[model samples]
Target: MSVTFNDFNLQTDLLEGIKSMGYKQATPIQAQAIPHILESKDLIACAQTGTGKTAAFLVPTLSRIAEGRFDFTSTLILVPTRELAKQIDDQVEGLSYFTGATSIAIYGGNNAQNWDQQKHALTSGADIIVATPGRLIAHMQMGYVKLDQLKYLILDEADKMLDMGFMDDLMKIINQLPKERQTLLFSATMPPKIREFARKILQQPEEISLSISKPAANIDQQIYLVYDQQKLKLLQHILKDVEVQTMILFTSRKSAVNEIVRALQKMGFEADGISSDRTQDERESILQRFRNKQLQVLVATDVMSRGIDVDNISHVLNFDVPQDAEDYVHRIGRTARAGTKGMAITFVNERDQERLVKIEKLIERELPKITLPEAIGESPVYDPAGNRAKFSRDKGGSGGGRGGNRSGGPRREGGSGSGDRNRSSKSRGERPAHVTAGAPATEQAPRVAGAPSTATGEAQKKKKRRKKPFKPKNAEGAGNSTPPAPAPAAE
Candidate 1:
């Protein structure tokens, strides 16, 4: 007894828009949610990314708005990120093309002109307003934005908003909304916090759970256990070996995003980093290029995990394991979308072993371990205890060609020492025909732009180990010079 969009009894305009968008069949979330949403009932839906949750709410919301509710801002959709706000606004525009329902997207990270435009939209009362929690709150605080006639309050990616520490802001925004509004809370994972938040906001909501907290089954998952220093080389090798059409690489840190993107670009891969550091315009441009397949790879933090909905993504790379298992699901869910077979590759270092274990537990299956190409270098042995075998730094240039360092130790190209030492940006060209394990130690490679500026303390400590001072027994007989207690042990 499967259902289609035609079964939902949506307004003619919305149905036409859905057809034009080529949405024939309803996703499980969409089918279950649309009926409840059209009934003006509160809903709490637990669905994964790529599950068509956005359209599930938008279609019905738009239909209700199209019923001559254009006099005031009737529907207020709160999302977690600026990117998501824009994404929803785009969908709203397409879905309401026939209905002529008006809407505006309000988000931060732009200048006064953007703010003024948003203020105008908010005060003038569009049919709908798609906004991030923070930005909407900012407008609410100013007392110009009005939602008195609001009939619907939708929280898309509610879990993500809470994760970003917007609980208080959400409360503020919710308190300002009319108490009689229809509330909908959609999330990927429903932990205690989400249940609590839903109870506070949603009124006896009908619940829907579709593949909750699980990634798409079509995604082929693989893991590579490598040392942190070797990740770049291994990534390069993988890109060369695999036919990656367009990929999103997720790292845990903003700095890592910049570093990985710079390194990849130096290697001649079309790559760019997107983070909070980038201006809104820059991020939009980067996203546009990525969507057009002009940018081959995008290195980003978890910010892009939930916001991006690009199709035909060939691969998703977890450059660093995410702290939360739910985040792991979202990161990988970027690929293998809409029944497309995509690949997810994770780079797991020794420290990320526990996080990796958590992800496996959440997904309820162990990802297959990938064998690194010989040219990339020797992969680290998997240690369940998270203890890595200690290897001395190779005096030679960062292990050239990934066969590993001259002494079989970790190698850095410019020099193996510390300080946000930038790896030399100078192209290493193609890997040597025959990598010499006995290559002579070379001078430190010059730092490339965006390379780590702080030297890791461990490397510096290894350089200055003082030999045990021999206490002179005949200090009274010979010119006895006290060793001054070994220089009082350097701090």
Candidate 2:
């Protein structure tokens, strides 16, 4: 049986705040975690996305703080991303409206006025602090934000922070926290790494594990076996076929974000994109628009997968398959939130068939694959095990469209932008694109002191070559000598 906020016997004013948010019933995670946190016991919680885990920790912690607390920053909520920090801070403000639990979100990315605000929040103190690990560490290094009197320490999205390699920062922050404080650890997936890490910081914590590796049942998942070039065309056809109020299109490559947004916009949809490359302020503005239903579609990379907290998302379209099977869950979890049904569609190309197979195995069921539209051309065969050479790399389409130029390599927009580089190489769990084929191991020179770097030497040779463009080697009446050839990257 599900419980309501009234059953928690929370403070009257605190219960008023919870009721004001229209949260009548407690989610399973909330039911399981709230009581333990109220009892001041260390807890480790595992729940899927969109399951009210944030409220699970926040409500009980706030109730405790409201039971009679001074102004010493009683609660510390540590998250992995600045967006999530801001999200929790917003929720804290809402849930603590009647109880008067003040909060400030501290994150990095600006140096001037932003720093001053963070410094003020740190020095003046608030009832709660929500911060990203790195930014909190930066403030902590300045020796102003103290937590000796903190009553509760919460690690939200603990797994993501660990995956982001914040173990050292987490430990450093934990070391400074009061040894007698209540600690709560919550994560979407309860991987073994999380349990191991929990053992280090949590003291005999009560364990609450819900469905961890699977997406919510409210999501109607579907798959499409598509050739790479057919993705945009099929996307356009589907949008024209259905009435999509709002959709989030996820791509593995940040470089593809802008192109997908551009293509969709050209098709007469109000579209925009957000990636790690965008400034935090820009991303916040775009997300605010998206949440307000001003944009019909939002193109993004995995950076927004777990960070986004918007609800009523009509659909989630995967422009490209995610490399991580777990990421597939979070990407699709953006929709079908809070018991509302939503659709999730994925595009699987020849190169990502192996990843698709792994996703099915992780989810413990094969997704229903839809046939490709005939007008878009034939899709590659979906034979992950026996079809290594079944599909040709160059068989998607004419590689020409307003969507993007697919005939050549990634559209070299000309500059040092990250979009111009091979993003697939830098994504987690994938090997760099510069394999032995791209760089011959036999040609690697030994590293010695004063050795000229490739880019620097290339720059010097380019200057020498440009000094006399009209001259050739030993040419008469042009120049005394010829310049060396340009390097490959310089070209």
Over the stretch 188-223, how does candidate 1's per-residue lDDT look in tens digits? 888899999999999989999876457778988989
Q: How far does residue 18 in candidate 2 sit from its true spot (Å)?
A: 0.8
> TM per model?
0.76, 0.77
Error of 2 at 70 (Å): 2.3
For every candidate, C-alpha RMSD to the true structure in Å: 14.7, 9.3
Model 2 lDDT tens row, 1-491: 77999999698889999999999999999999889988889999988777789999999888888986677888899887767888889898899999887999987553346667877888998999998776676667667888889888999988777765567778888899888988999987787889999999999999999874577788889899886678888998888887788899987566678888888889899999986667678989999999999999988776456668777888999987775677788788778777888889999876567778889888898899898788888877778754433323223343322122233324212112122223331222111112223332111211233323323454566566674355555667555455666545421
Task: Tell me model 2's lDDT, rounded to 2 decimals.
Answer: 0.74
Q: What is the Cα-based TM-score of model 1? A: 0.76
The lDDT for every candidate, in the order shown, is 0.73, 0.74
Error of 2 at 402 (Å): 24
The candidate that wins on TM-score is 2
